[model samples]
Target: MSAPFQDKVCLITGAGSGIGRATAVKMASLGASLSLCDINYDNLSATAKQCASTPRHLDDVDVGSKQEVEKFIKDTIGKLGGIEFVFNCAGVNPTSIPLEETSDEYWDRLMNANLRGVFNITRGVIPHLKRGASIVNVSSISGIRGSAQQAVYCTTKFGLIGFSKCMALELGPKGIRTNVVAPGYIDTPTNAGIVKGGEAVTRMINGNALGRLGTPEEVADVVAFLFGEESRYMNGAVLEIDGGIKMSSTTSSGK
Candidate 1:
């Protein structure tokens, strides 16, 4: 058979790094036509370089801004045609701090990027989504459980789950599928410092059933599956790609 994504139009936000970049590369290899955006143009250009030969449009977009998202979506449809897949992978990670120490600035930052950004992109793309389109949102294992020093971050993620579920119900009759992926302790640019620390690494491995941190590519594969025909019947599903961290007693202390 031809590649599963052959000729399909896939839109990925946060495509500058981490899981988003990984997914873009994977989808490109599978023959997807892509529209990729990130707030960082240099990083985004690097990602685009690695996905050479695929039909793609690149734009520097801050998904948190409705205007930026709307413009990018308009440009994408004008360039790549209608969207068949969306990966809402843009978000900010939390800093370890007591709730009292969590500044208003910090709260707003995470809320804007993690929650509101998803809202902007999803809402803007709905009108352009082709029938049977699929959307996979990236949340965190912290979303499903409580974590110390991450109250606001957890709140945004938890809120994201509720929002995605509601969208699934609202868009189901339209033949669109919406889902979430909650990953735990991923090895990404955002967590590079943490993973480099001996104590933090040990804590993360201990909490994970796989005994190691997950890779961005691993999460990307699951996102790709959710967008593929294989997951046709799945909707409103929140899959945990956390190395079984949720089932373990030990948990990362957000250090």
Candidate 2:
């Protein structure tokens, strides 16, 4: 009966699946008006249907394209009136390979999808964000620590952290707070290959202090908190929802 996000307008990228889908559903349930986008139309439609009763507008978009991102922002603002919260969850998980073996094209693809996507969206939305707006960017634990054969992936995520921190500094004075969420070993479709990779995955799961993978919903809960008034004092902070993977040394979850 109580909706914390009532009257709030939220913009979420990558709303087709994983943490992004979960967050969209969460915010909708909390009474937020939503503007969602993802490259996958079918999946994005499914997400929208789940919250069909809520006020929402969605489109298929590639966040890596600056022109596409700008258009999405314009359309979202035009429909929703304005944005109060933003969740940047559009990204790609790369194939693991040595830096030497990683081709220039592949590296650029990863950077563009994982890093530039966030950049494009953030830049497009700054002028439209209302005072006291909140932004949560999805980073990976790889951004905090290195991993094997994930040179390009790590590079993009690490770059995301720096950019988000800078957003916090630049936007905080405007009363818009920006924060980052670094999730480790989440059981999302993006990590389906690693999740089913037999013993390697088992050992990885055991390494987390919780000895389990986190769910998209679990991470969504933290994201909702970050956007809510409860975390008003929190700014430029990175919250890890990795089931203690960051603290455990025995597990190499390939986050």
Candidate 3:
């Protein structure tokens, strides 16, 4: 049988490490050509090297900047021909600051990196997307339920749901499907910084039905699924990859 993504060009932002990297590797394995970007050159190169067998390109661009994203997407098309799928995974986790102490500077920074970054890239790629193309934006479980000290993060994710919904509605006419993937606590460098060990880690593990953190590969699996023709009928969907953390409150409530 032929590979699922053969001849298709995939664009993934924040392709340096974690779920982004995992997705890059997985997609390439499915015979997709790759165009990846990240602010971290080192990590980006690492992902590229792993997908060396496929036609791949790497760029260091800030997704938050419209100009940068535009140039990057255009470059991808110029080199790879056209974009068929986009994984808007470029975003930063929020700083655990109380709402009272959060400053405008900090909020703007995260917003630029998270919500605006998604908007910038997704909007830039609209004109270039092939019909039947799929767009998957990586959202966090916090986006749905809200997290303590993550007011801004939650806000951005909430905004993404609306944004995806709008994209789905508008672009659905053009055969472009837009969806969001809301992953629970996964073992990624970003999360490692905030919940490495001790009470926080234990608390998170305990809160999940599986009683353990998730892996980037696990989340990538769903992303890959969402991009394939198997999910062709799916649009404007926000699929969660958590370990049933949201399914039952008893896990965390200790009831």
The most accurate candidate by lDDT is: 1
lDDT of 1 by residue, 141-235 (tens): 87898777778988999999999999999998999999999988777877633645787667777777788878889888899999999999999
Error in Å for residue 247 of model 3? 7.8
lDDT of 3: 0.84
To one decimal, what is the Cα RMSD in angstroms of model 1 from the true structure?
2.1
Clashes of 1: 0
Q: Estimate each model's TM-score.
A: 0.95, 0.95, 0.94
Model 3 residue 19 distance off true place after TM-score fit, in angstroms: 0.6
Which ranges of candidate 1 are over 4 A from the true structure?
192-196, 246-255
What are the per-residue Cα lDDT tens digits for candidate 3 across 210-244? 88878889888899999999999999999987787
Poorest stretch of ten by lDDT in candidate 2: 246-255
TM-score, model 3 to reference: 0.94
**Over the stretch 188-214, how does candidate 2's per-residue lDDT look in tens digits?**
777734655887577657767898878
lDDT of each: 0.87, 0.86, 0.84
